[model samples]
Every structure is written in C-alpha cells, then in structure tokens.
Target chain A: MSVTVPSGFRASGVVANLKSTGKPDLALVQNLGPRHSAAAVFTGNRAKANPIIWSERVIADGVVSAIILNSGGANCFTGSFGFQTTHQTAEAVADALGVSAGDVLVCSTGLIGVGDQEFRDKIINNVPAAVEALSEDDDSAQLAILTTDSVAKTATYAGDGWSIGAMAKGAGMLAPGLATMLVVITTDADLSSVELNHALREATRLSFDRLDSDGCMSTNDQVTLMASGASEVIPVLADFIEALKSVCSDLARQLQGDAEGSSHDIDIEVIHAKDEHDAEVVGRSVARNNLFKAAIYGNDPNWGRVLAAIGTTDATFDPYAVDVSMNGVRVCHAGEPDQPREMVDLTPRHVSVLIDLKSGDATATIRTNDLTKEYVHENSAYSS
Target chain B: MSVTVPSGFRASGVVANLKSTGKPDLALVQNLGPRHSAAAVFTGNRAKANPIIWSERVIADGVVSAIILNSGGANCFTGSFGFQTTHQTAEAVADALGVSAGDVLVCSTGLIGVGDQEFRDKIINNVPAAVEALSEDDDSAQLAILTTDSVAKTATYAGDGWSIGAMAKGAGMLAPGLATMLVVITTDADLSSVELNHALREATRLSFDRLDSDGCMSTNDQVTLMASGASEVIPVLADFIEALKSVCSDLARQLQGDAEGSSHDIDIEVIHAKDEHDAEVVGRSVARNNLFKAAIYGNDPNWGRVLAAIGTTDATFDPYAVDVSMNGVRVCHAGEPDQPREMVDLTPRHVSVLIDLKSGDATATIRTNDLTKEYVHENSAYSS
Candidate 1:
C-alpha cells in the first residue's frame, strides 16, 4: 500500500525471466490522473546507463505518463543497441498507456553491460502483461526492482488533504551525490512540475544524498517523482517540501539498514562545523574510511581512527580542538583520549559517532555501514 | 645491506620490550659524517603523531645527525604525554651520539594511542644499547621497523662514484601523500642539503606518493634522506635524482607487493589525459574504488566498473571515448564492450589496467591492491 496510499496511481510487478532465479523482474507504475506532472534526478556518474539517458529526456518536458523498470541487467555500456532497448521500452509503455513515447521513462538495474536482443525481447514481450496486472492496491512493484537488497523499502506521509508515497531499492554501490538506488515517489497534491522538482531536490539533498555506504556510485541510479492532481489540495510549497522530505528520509534509513553484508549501521554526525559543506565533508570522510568502518565491525571503539579519517578532509576544524563520542561515550576530548575505550560498547547494530568541531553551529549526518569480510566476499562473488 | 650499503653510516636494531613478541623493536641510524646533510617528508595528515611532529622540526635545519625509530606503538593522539615520550627518545639518541637533541629525528609505528610511561621507558632505555651495537654492515634496522610486514623492504642504487641505499616498512594504510611507512635513505654522494631535499621530493612524488593500497592515510609516515658525503664525488643533480628515484621506486614496489592481505598488485595506468594531474586523478580514482578492487580480487575483468570509477573524477576525459584494457586484453573499446571479458585472465598476481583517455599525451600510473576477505579481516582485527 506504499505508492497506492496516494490516489491516482496504479502499479504492477511481472516475471520476465530476466533474473535466473525466476523472480519477478519487471515493474510498471502509471499516473492515472488528470494532471501528469513529474520530476526526476539521475546518477551523477558520467558513464550513465541507457535507461538513464532516456529517462533524463523524458523528465525534460515536465510531463510523464508512466515509468517502467527492470532488474537483472543494468543495460549500461551496451552501446547503441542498449539505447534502442530503452527507447523501445519507453515506446511499449507509451503504447500500453496511450501516451506519447517521450512522456514515458525507463529504468534498469542488475549487472552492467548486459542489454542484448534476448534481454530486450523479454522486457518488450512482457509489457502488456505488466499493464494488464496494474492495480492501486498492488505493492509487488516494490519487490521487482531489488537486486541485492534484503527487503523492500517503502514509506508514506499524510498531509492536510494530500499525501506522499515512495519506494526505494539499493543494497550496495551507495555513495554521495545520491546513493546507487532507484526511487519512485508519488504524490496526490496539486503541484506544478517545477514545484515538485524544487521540493524533490530539497528533500533528497538531506536524505538520499547523505548515504555513503561503500562509497561507490552506480551508472543506473535515478529518483523520480510523479504528481497526479486527483486530490485537488493546493499544498503550501513549504508544507509539501516538508512532507516529501519525511518520506524520503524514511526510505533512506530503510536502505541503510539493509545495506549489503553490513554488520552495523553507523551514523557519523558532525557538529559545530563552520558551514554545512564542511560538516558534510567531515562526516563523509569518516563514512568512507574503511579502517573506521572495519573498526566498528570489530567493536573496537578505536577513536584514533575517527580522528585519522577526519584528518584527511580539508574541513575547517582545528585538529586539537575536536571531540569524538562513540555510542554516547566521549572517548576523545580535544583530540586527546578522554574515557577509556572499554567504556564504549559497539555490539549493537546501530552505532553513532559524534564529532564536535568546536567551530560554528552547522551540522550534518552521514549514514554508512561497517566493512566486513562478508562484504568483500559478496562483492567479489557478484562479478558486477 | 640496506641503509648501511652507503659509506659513513652506522645502523643497529635492539630489543626494546615494546613489542609483545620480544623481537628487535628499536632501531638507530647515525651519520658518521664527513658531512651531515639531510631532508625528510612527513605524512600530510593533519592529525600527526608525536614522532612526526618531532621529526618535522628536526629536519627543518637540514642537519639530522641520527634518526631513531621503534615499532609496536604509533604514539599518536596520546596527548602531551606522547610528545614528551618522543622528546625523551630523541634526547636519549642525541646523548648517546653526542649530538644536539634538536638534530635527532624520531619515528614510531604499530598501533596508535599506545604511548605511556612504560612505552617511553622501554624506548629510552634501548637507545644506548642500539648505539653500542651499531655496525656499518649490519642490516637489522630494516627488520626492526616492520610491524605486520612479512619481510623487510630494501633497495640500493650505485652511481658513478657514489651510492644510495634505502629501507622502507609499510604493510597497510597506504595512500597518496605517502604510504604508512618509515623510510631512511643514505647516500655517499657529496651533495648539499638543498640538493638532497630537491631530489628527495622529486623522487617521492613519483614513487611512494603514487601508491594507494588501502586509501587510509597514517599519522606517523615519514621518509628521510641523509647524505654523508664520504665518497668525495660531486655528482650531477640529474644523475643523483635519477639514482634516488630508482631506489625509491624499487622500495615502493616492494611495499606494494607486501601490502596486507592483498592478492593482486594492480597498476592502474591512465594515458592520454589532458595533463599529468588528470591522469593521476583518474588512476587514483580507480585504484581506490572498492568495487573495482573486489572485482580484480575475484579474478573478474569487469571493465565497466573501471569506466564508472573514472567517470566520478573531474579529470579531462570523454566518458564515451575511453578504452580500458586489463592484462593486455581490451575489454572495453571506446566505452563499449569489445573483447569478451572471458578473454582476459586475471588469475595472475600482477594485474595491469590501461585506460586510454584519448584526450592528450600525459599519463600516470597508480599502484593498489585488490580488496579481499583477508583484507577486511586483518583491518577489522587490527583496531588501529
């Protein structure tokens, strides 16, 4: 009931034999509304997938009729043929929904460099069935887009007379400038595409853009927001943005909790930074430090690693004036060992590291996961 | 025959009881100088260790008489007490060698935050014993500086009437700016301290500064070059720089080979970039990418990950115009799959990734190691 919690949306999941395990691998979400306004954000990676290239153009006109996504193949680096597959996917969706092909978006995920004739044929042949199975109450579309994710992530927010619903799928290759995940959000508010775009950028900047698990960007990441003006509540811009942020934040945490091969979900919160950018830079430096993550995995409470990691960043902070607290224990104060390391226990799955820069009031939190042997093994065996 | 391979230098290793294994953990290298001219480089990390702070000041006058180093403790983030320990150790070395305490450099490695009164007592007490055991032919100093390294790393370059010998110790926390190792280079060439400084900087910029094994910067990294001027041969600056570079490059490779838990030593060479900086940025981006490293560890030639990594960098390269070759097989040509991945065999320990940016003639190569399960386990258990 995630995306369907809002009115004027229909979604469906279908099996396309794309995944070798015979799981549902294709999904379609349609805006059955009087207003078909939309906005999107694609991966910052220069080497983008074909679907991303197509979807970027689809959102350029501020109008979208439907979005189609598939798993088990990224359709990246497949060259002109792969681009044709994405064009064909959008065309198929347009034909099924009786809309222009330019208004349909496409997304694909799995392994990179996989789009071939067979892959195209399966997606194209299964479109009608996916359209036939569309219903407002069906939540199976959330399950179709997952690759290595352990669970489906979805959230909904109820406003005065409007509502926002969202779904996200990501397990690895997560980093800043947006995690390697596909997000589809639907809202039943009477907002223009420009307004929706502004709200989405504001919301994702604080939520999805702060997750840096493994620090790997993907070629096929995208976040799409579609608005259908069935519930004719003209929401305040500030109120709509706040509601959207809550939904995005809820889904981002779910993604962090389910990151691949992770033992602990860690939050690196930097406080008293000179600016928000400096706070984010310091937090991300620690988030991407493998030594810090591995120390958390071993429950070592090694606060020196925290300092060592932040030392690499050019954030405006005095090295000797910083304080670090792990799990509420001030293990280090003014860059000197304060409490004994044994006083801090990292056995819980949720770990928090607070760093005070003693500069200004700006603060930021970056979410990451502990590095483990299982992470190496899973990534090594994935071959993507 | 490492540091003592050159004339006018005496080195010794002594048991300090600082190491739990009771092996030789303290080393001293003194310039029995006709001329004592020296230059050094310390870790660029802002949160530096006590020894790095001491050595950076000692090398300022370009007249280091002796250098003392110890393993089993890094003496970092241990507050004012740690600085006192480093000062005491240097003073003890100066007292034994009859030189100024300001002229004696200090270096420490092993775990961070371990400096205490007991640590100081062991190191200070062992200085005289190390000085008494000094011999020009004994190569024990190389073994004394090793922490987790399986074997000592040493190199020698004999010039026209002069010679250079160097020893380095680093197994992990290797990154740009410098590897997490202590290095001492000795030269018999009659050169000024300024000349040695120029040569040392130029050599290290291409050698130790290009190794990015784990992308973790250390707080105690230092590289020192001492000239004893015993050969009475005033060598050309170009020839001296070349000889120093050869020795540093040899030891850098040895450190790369002995990187902790690494299965493959990867050389990511980026060619035809707009400039050397762009090439290095692109190469280091790939070297530090965990996904690309894990793929190499699994013996999979996943060239798409290579493109994804370089795409994240601001380097001057057209994303679609890049070509990636793994071990001589061009897996991606012009950003599209050319040779099948099966054609590239990655089972060998030495793997080469050649990325042709097709933008300019400048090039650079970054050395790294494949991410493996053993790497995660080793780092997780190390606690520092």
Candidate 2:
C-alpha cells in the first residue's frame, strides 16, 4: 500500500521554513515497533554530508528508532557547524519521539555547503509539531524530502505474510556509488539486523547501484531499511532478498524516469562480456557518454558513439567483433553497419541500447537518462 | 604566421566532395626538405580510426614526407574496407607527392563509421588536384579539418632562426587520452627524431593533455610533429620544449574557447595537492562536473558544486580543510561559505575557479567548457 502500511510505523511532515517556497521542508518517520532494527547504506563519496557522516555512526550498532529528513540543504562540506546542525536536529527529533538521540538517523538534500545555525534552528523548532502530527495515513512525509524531483517516488512489494515499502527522492546527482540518492524502506517482516544488513547489501548492489541516471554522484545519498518485526512471521532469506531487490529496483526506475530535464530513459544492456565486471564497465561507459545520451534524446541511432564509448573501457572485446542493437534492430554488426539507422524508432520514453561484446557469457544493465536541452536548462536555471 | 611558416613546408586545402557542404574537405602539408623526421601521438582509445592505424606504422621510422588530412569522415569502425580506404588514400598522396606510401601520414575527422566506397573514392580521386593546388600562401588547409568548430585553431611560435607552428580541429570529444582531436605541428629545428619524441612528449604532457572540454575521448585524435630541419639551427632543448609547449597550450586554449555551444570557458586550478597527479585528479574532477559547469553557464557562483566535484577524487586532502575561490574571491573557506555569491561575475566568457586543497605545494590547471542548451542542440542535431 504505502510506506506507513508497514506495521508499527508512523510518519508526518511539516513546513520548517527551510525552503523559501513555503513547501513542506521537514519530515519524520518513526518505528513504533515490537523490535527496532535497521540496516543502511551511504554514498561512497569521501567528502560526505554532515547528515551522512552522523548517520553512518548511528547505524553502526544496527538499531534505529526514528529518522528525520529535510530537503532544503544537503548539509555537506558545511564545516563543523553543519555537523552540529545535523547532530542537534537528530537530538530534537529523538526528544520529540521519546527515543535515544544516538538511535536517530538524519537525511538531508539540496544545495551543498548550506545548513547554517539558522537552518538548524528552524528544523529543531518545528520537530515537535511534526512529531505531534504523526499518523499512519499521512502522505506528507514523502513530499518533504525532495530537492529537484517533480514527483514523489514510492514502491511496495508484498509477500504472503509481510510487505516491504520504500520511498526515495532525487532528480539530479543520480549516479551509482551504492545508494545513488536518499531512500527509506520499511518492513514488518521478522528478521535480525544482521540478516537485514546482508539482504539490504545484496538488494541494493543489484538495484540502486545499477541506476546511473546521471554521472554525478551525490554526497548525501543514503538508503536505510528499517524492520519492525511486528508481523511475527520470519520469511526465508532468499524470498526476502528478492522482494527487497524488487522494491529497490522499482524506486531506481522511478528515479530514472524523473531525472532532471531528461527526454528519454535509456537502458544500456552490455552482454557477452568476459565477466560481469567487464560488462559493468562497458555499461557504465555507455551510460556516461554524453554524446550517446544526447543522440538517444534526439531519436538518432548514432551507433558510432556507442562504439566510441565502448572503446573507452578495458572490457575484453575485439573492436571488430562487437555488435550494437537499438530496439532489437542491429545497427552495428561485427563493428560494421547492419541494419539501416532509419529503421530504429526511438520516439518512445523507454529506449533500449544493447551491446554485444561476443567475448564471453556475461551481462550487465545500466539505467540512464538522455541528455537534453531541457536537462541543461533545468540544471542551470537556479542555485538549487 | 601559420602551419606553413616552418622552413621547407608547403600547405594547401581543397574541396574533394567528401563533405556535402562543399567546403574544403581535403588538406595537405608537405615537407620538401633536406631532412625529413617526425614524431606523432595517437588517441589511446582502443577502437582507433583507420587513419590512426595506418599512420601509426607510417611514422614508425620517424620519417614523414607529407600529410593528407580530411574532414567529414572519421573512418572509424568502418570494417576492413575503411582500413583499405586509409591505405589507398596514403598511396594516392604518395603517388602525387612522388614518395613512398610508407612516408605519408593520413588523418581524418567527422562522423565515425563513414569512409565507405563512395567516401573513399572522393578522397582517392581528388589527391592529384589537391597536390597540384599546393602553395605556401594558399592558407586553406586549416579550414579543411574543422567539423562543428566555430573557428580554426592555429598557433605559431617564432624564435631565433627556428620556428614552430601548429593547427588543430576539435570542438567536442576533447578529453585527455593523449591529444584529443586532429593536430599537426611543424618545426624547423635541427633535432633528431629521438630528441623530437622526447620534446613532443614533454611539451604535450602539460598542454593539450590537460584540456578536457566535454569529457569525451575521441577515436581519431592525432598530434604529429614533422621536422624539416631546413633551418640548421640546433636550438637548446629546454627552450624549444618551452616554445613548443607554448604553441600547444595556445591551441588547447583556442579549442576550449570554441567548444560547442559554450558560453563560458572554465579554467579550474587545483592547488596545494600532494603531487601533480593529485592536482590533476582534483582539477579534472571539477572540470568534468556537469553541475558545476551548468552553474557557471547560468552565471551563478555555486561553490558547493565545486567542492562536491573534487570530493569524488581520491586526492589527498581533508574535505574540511579545503578552500574554493571564484574570480579571486574566496567563496568557501574551511569548507564553509565565505564570500557572497553575488561577488563573482560569470558574464564574461573566461571564468576562473581555484580550489586550494591545503595538502601540499603541487598545483594543476584543467580547461573545460560550460554545458549549455546550444551544446546539447549542436551535439544532438546531427549524427556527427
């Protein structure tokens, strides 16, 4: 159903004056559970945000009772004061929720190097009202944690006894480095924190880690999985892992679809490589090729750019032995022209670009958004 | 002074019908010299163009009598027929110049996967006319190698009894994996092939290799230096290297200035890194950041994007100890805001961004272009 559909969870959102537009800028999600346990992943970028730096330590012991998120400032590279802002915000949230300050996770997204003392004070003062308004049916929490995204992203995959629910927010700086953006997934399934960590890693490794809508990696990306253990039904690890991956993949695709100013969402599948890593290398190269992405946006089947992108990688493939297909019409065969470029229809929102290395039996798929004039305009329009 | 300024060199350009625009599509530069020696560098892309494959072996012995360059067809990934086309083009140039095919270097630019039979015929059939029209004062050669470039890039360094001249063509796909795009530099100094190779490597290492305009590596990049040795002056090695580097750097800047659809030419300087490599790592990371580039194009002093960009690199630096300056105003100090955002003016084409790593004394500069709507339009307008 929704993020709040999971057992023993309540969410609410309030206007904290963090954003000048007067939109909801503060959000809270609490685990009112029989058992409180969580697993989380963060952006691998070394220069992380203050919130990420704080939550990394908070999640180390694998217990999280509440989460506070904001979309006004990333609170990244904001110096020691910004760290204090993140710390005090978590403390305020813990006080409101009757939880330990160390057991709260904080997430932030917006312009980098923001979140000064004034920003911190606004979040702390509004936290009590956000906590008082918490309800299982409130839909505003998901609306408050978006920076540039035009739509809210949420997904659910229910099993026979328990269900997993997820929410994410990102439209730019979406790249693959573990979690590409800020996300939260809640479940009622009974599982230990260790099992949740293992399953989260495997799920995100195959899902969010493969979604590279843009080549820009954010500094505040975090994906946290909180389990309430209120369903009283322990599921098989294999099934739980699959369900978690499905939800993550759903959110990943939603993020890709809402990428900033993108005209088309491209799925680059690199197959027949020497190994899975080689396939991933080739896929990422294609994903990062601005020329190829622009051509896709223009509905032009420019296979040469694809080959040129592939040439950038160290994947095992003879230059003359690779093949490329657009929408199942082979434009390049054995590194030469196969089908005419006019036959490939690319007007749809979803585009598939398949590259065959003809080296070994391995495959990888990378999700990306096409580079368009609108994307350029949207990203360059304002400071945010 | 132009590429023809070098002693014992003649240049000309002609229309071979290779380009549909009927512009000059073929260019020739010959060394009618007493001593013929040369050095060259090709693109590091694994899938190289046919001309690159041919000229690599032709310049093996460090002797080059003439060069035949064409626009409107990169002749890359055109299968075996493209290789044959390059081979035949060299032979045709050799037949017209009264030299061995092994002594002629061939260069091509334009769309990849071209150089089919018709395209190759246009080149092979026009060699005699191009040779007959060769004149030192024709000055059409530089105009022939341009594709998508708003202006021709040429530079000359006059010295005591010796000179160096060069011409380059690239508005896109200008990344550092060897010298990006097509360039030919001629020198009249009496240096051996070994000395020329060493000097060329050292000179280009600091110039063309530091320009990363669009972060797209080309498949047909070539930088060739032909020494006529006509001016029998054996200049000091260090002085000649400096002058050569000056010309290369001048050309690199011109390419950056004329980058496709760019309104701002961004110069990112990384200072106080651990070493030159670390400096380069930090500088290039900032140069390749689309968010930072877009902000520059928007005339916004968004220093946070700069910090976020450098954070992606593994260069030795504490994130909190960094300082970023825009147009001489320190916008960020100790990873916090310092100067006002309105203090920086990006209305001019030349924008300077300085990042102080506070790690060491090493420094490096990277030249890049801002991403704009016109860049997206031009790149997506045609298959090239």
Candidate 3:
C-alpha cells in the first residue's frame, strides 16, 4: 500500500534466519523509473550503525536505485567487520537488481552491539531471494522493517496529478535522534532530488522529529525518500510539499499510537513561548519526564509534575505565570490550581496536554506516550 | 542517629495527620548554639515550592536556629495560601523554640499543585506539640521526612575533633537538580557561615549531585547544614569538609538503595573523560537511559543500549574507542564486543558499570536504579 502506490516501485519481504524467531526479516524495495532521484536522513547519533554509514554516502548523489532492509541485528558498534557486512549486503542486492552498488541503500534494525556471524550468513544467503520475490506489493516490505511494532504503518496522501506514500516501523527507543525507525517514502511527483530533500526535511521536522516516545535515541534510524517521476505530471511544489508532510505526519502518529507497551498517546501542545526553540525545549523536558508520563498513565491530571519539568529547562517562562490544561480541563491557571483534576477524563487512549508558558506568542508541539507497567515489563523481559 | 550524632542538636517528630497514611509527618530540629551559622542549597527549578522560597531567603542571613519539615504536601503551585501556610509553620516553630522568625526554615514534600486546607490546619495545630517533645532524638526526625521511601536514611562521619551527621529522604524525581531530597545535616565544628557554605557546596557537588535515578528534577529539593559551634572543636577546614562529604555520600547511597520500587542500585563510574563535567554528563546519560536500565533489570548485559545512550552525550570521547564493563566484565571493549555477555552476572542488586571514555584523566560516578515493573506499578497506582 506504500511503495506501489507510487507509479514505479516494487518491494518484497523474505524470511531469513537473521531473526531468531524465523520471521520475515529481509525486505527489498526497487525503484524502476526514468528518474531515480532520492533523498534520505539518518540518525543524529554519533555512534551510527553499519548500514547507516553505508547509506549516507549512497544518498549523497541524490540517486537511489534500490534499498535493502533487515531486522534482528543492529550491526552497530561491531567494528570494521560489521561495516564490511553492510557493504557486501548492498553489493549483493545491487548485483541481483542490476543496479549500481553505489546507488543501493541499506538499513538494519533490532539488537544493538554485536552482529552475529550466523545472522550475517543468513542475510548474505537471503538477499537474492528477497530480490527475486520483489513485486508491486508494498505490504511485505512494511512488515519486514518492523521490530516490536504490533501493526504495519502505511500512509498515503493523494494530490491532483501525483501521490506521496510511506511505510514506517518503530516501537521502542522513540526519541528524536530519529526515534529508532526505518522508513521508505515513494512519490512519482516529477521532482528533483533537491526538491525531495527540501520537502522531506520540512515534513520530518514537524513529524518524526517531534515524536519522542521513550527518550532513547537509536543508532540505526533512517528515512529514505525515492521519487520515480513516473507519473510524468508535475504539480505545484508547495502543494506537493503539503501532501508529503501529511503522509509523514500520518505515519508519525501511527508510530506514536503503536509505541511499545504504551496505554495513552499524548500530544503536548506548548504555546506562548519566547521562541520556537524555547517552546521545544520546554516540550521535550516534559516529554522526557518519566514522573509526568507515569502520572498520565494513572489518569492523574498532575499539572505540578508538568511545572516541575518546565522548571528544568532554560525556556523563557515565568514559573508562576504558566498555565496547564489536561484535555479540556484547566487544571492549572497561571501556575496555580484552577479546575479540579477529576474534571479531566483520561479513560481514552489519546491524551492532550496544553502548556501555556506565557512568555511570548511562539508555539511548538511534541508527541509522547504515557509510561505504563506494560512498558517496563516489556522492556525488562525483552532481553531475558 | 542523624542530627544528634553531632553535639548541640535536639530533634523531635510527631504525627500531624498530614499524610493519608497517618504516619509521622512533622519534625523539628533545634540548635543549642554558641554561634548559629548555617548554609543551604535549594532546587534549581524555577517553579519554587513555598517552603523552598521561604528557606532560600532565611539562609541568606547565614544563621538558622531551627528547621521545620513535613512530608505530606509539597506546598508547590498552591497559590498565595500555600505561601501563607509555609510562613505560618515557620512562625510557629520559631515561637515555640523562642528564636527569631527569620532564623527558622521550613521544608515540605509530597504531591504538588494542590495543598489542602486541612493539611495546613493540621500542621498549624501540631507544631507546638512537636516542639514540646523535642529531645536528642535524630531517629524520629529522620522518619518524619520520608514520603514513599521504604526506610529512613541517616549517615554519620566522625572527625578527630568533631563529627558530622545527616538525614535525607528521596525516592522518585531523582535527577540532580540536587536530586529531589530533603536533607538536614548537623555538625559541631566551629566554622563561619562562609566556611560552612564552602564545605557544604564541595561535599554535595561530588555526592548528592551525582545521583540521578529518573531524571526528573523536583520543585521542593532542599539541603541545609546547620553548625551549632557548641563543640568548639576546629580541625583543619579541609579535614572537616572531608568528613562532611563522607556523610553526604553515605546518605546519598542510602537514598539510591532505598529508591521506590528499585530492583537494582547501579553505580555508573565514568573514567578517563575530558573533565569532571564530561564524566558526569556521560555517566548521567547512561543512568537516565530506560532501555539500559531495563536491560539491567533483566540481568541482560546489553552493552549496546549503553553505547546508544553514551552516543547521545556531548562528552569528549572517541566513539569507537570507548570501553564498557559490567560487573567487572568488559562486555564492550573499544566500542566493540569483548567478553561474552553471559560471562557477566547481574543477579546482585548492586550493579557497577565502568565506562572508560579514554579521552582524559578526569572521572565521575552517577548513582541510579534499574527500571522495573514494580516502579511503574507503584508510580502508576500511587495517586489514589
């Protein structure tokens, strides 16, 4: 429903022993087109994975012919050997797809630290099978990229003469050093790689970058955008950018809703700040506050926890002049108690927290999730 | 035996119906001093609690005759009436102890935002009774200042001429905006307010400020040191500072050990950093990482989570040249896998992690607790 939604993309997922569970772990996306202009973004983390290091250089020329993905081994911090493995995997995919090795992007997720020899063997042996099975079906690619996510995430934004479609996979480690996810977006909107980069950056700034789930930054986060220009119909760049942003936003929301073991999806709308940076600083401080997140899970409209988080930031705000609202209830007005907390209902899965810093008119929003027992349980038992 | 471990200190605790548990919640500490010199540090948060605001002003005079503490409500964001409650509590303590009102300090800890009128009424009615029960009983005062802690924490350090003793209480909100603790330290070493301030600052900098469990800075954290000068025993100022630091470090460890719902007490010893600040930044980054904490909870030596967290910091280090050791087993050597993870054992509640940044000679240690289901359960079900 994603890559194929654009005119010239084929994808497939293949089962490989790369995953101990023997689930589908290899995915291939081939862009067949008159123009294969592409743009990509990688994790902000300084400790990058092997595939990330490889793909960063591949996307430098703004051209990508095919992309390869695997789950179950991060291939991060595995020294030079892991880097070689990533390079070889891309080479194998390039050979099978009849594309240049330099234009093949690779992404891998799952366990961090070591890339097991057995997993590498499986990936090497299975790359050709994934390539051979590639079809116009995007579902397999979407499924293969997931780690702990419970559902496949795909979104489409249609325009007059073109469309933007994307598939994303993420569950835990959802903080803004790109939130531990692999994403592939496809569009046939007759745009150059520079335009694709501009639109991708702008959309992600307001989407995936603002979604902070558990405050853990991964080393393997990557988002790739491939434009085939197969529609041969050009639309206004501004409108196309808007459509691209909608798709990114939709996928970001889906990731938030499916965050590992979370019960409530939270959107913090920070308003009236000195500047956009101040607004984001305040919002992220709140988003990373485990106490505030736990309180939300309890259905407790604990605005003072919000205040405590606000105080931790250098954001421009008078502590006593701020106001906080949970849902539609003004639990705190001007930093003091206002409506009763009981007036706010938190039985639903979606929670909205509004903080008015009352310093300036600037605003920003951050998406997060309520920390729950299941979250701790899942994370604690995961490694075991 | 906290306050009275030093000379010229009398303390008492009484039930004030402040906490719903109806346990001891009010405490008074009086100094029978030849010189009433004191030093204090308050939470760095901009959202100051009522008691924190009052105590900051009182400590500026460098004299404090007594301190009043309660552990039911934080008196934060509770409007003008909450400020009045703090003022009235301090006045009551001063009146009962026959000291100047300006020389009395107050501290409160519990739920934030709403300070019930009934809680104020009970505190006002019970202050005189606590004063009447005053004795050289540091044990009672220690118990009165705890909220969710499983035990009252106390530490004593003996010097050649005098001794230093302290009591502290903290559970959640254990990030270092001075670590969300209400602490009162007493010493009989004859020193000026300036000297006491210098010693206190130095001691807390390496001790209390290094403990970061949940990364949530609190609004009501306060640490105060009162010198009665009754012993008139002046050792070298440096030796006195060392004794004070020992007491602070001991109490800080006890706080970490008794942190609510903690299954493991972790000491992240960061070595060979660019500076002490870099060491601390790197250590706290690892300490606050929930994924790493959860991995420890499961007894899984997931060194990659540690690397992922370390990569988030700006500490000077070669990303590929760092080493991480868990429980004396170097699982990650120079950012690559070293010992088999199964060689490390995390069965003990006390876990030590050594990270060698390999940048410089400076080092620091951060104290934390593993994220566990019990923590999430306690925090989630706490409000009711």
lDDT of each: 0.88, 0.86, 0.86
Per-residue C-alpha lDDT of model 2 across residues A220-303, encoded as one tens digit per residue: 889999999888889999999999989988888888889888889889999899999999899988888878888888899999
DockQ of 2: 0.80
Per-residue CA lDDT of model 2 for B125-227, tens digit only, reads 9998889988866578999988877789999999899999899898643344322388889988898878888888897788878888878888899999988
Please, what are the lDDT tens digits per residue for candidate 3 over residues B85-183? 999988888888888889999999888874768978999999988998889755788888888888888888888778887888886323344235899
Candidate 3 chain A worst ten-residue window by lDDT: A171-180
Candidate 2 has an lDDT of 0.86
Q: Could you give the DockQ of candidate 3?
A: 0.80
Query: How do the residues A1-384 of candidate 3 rate in per-residue lDDT, one tens digit apiece?
Result: 787798888999999977777778898898898789999988878788889999999999999999999988888999988998899998998888888999999999988865767767889999889988888865788888877888999998788878777888995322344236988999888889999999889988888889889988989999899999989978798898888889988888998999888999999999999999999899998988888888888888878888998998888888889889999899998878999888999999999999998899899999989888888877777751
Residue A238 lDDT, candidate 2, scale 0-100: 97
Pairs clashing within candidate 1: none
- In angstroms, give how far residue B156 of model 3 lies from its true place: 1.4
The DockQ ranking, best first, is 2, 3, 1
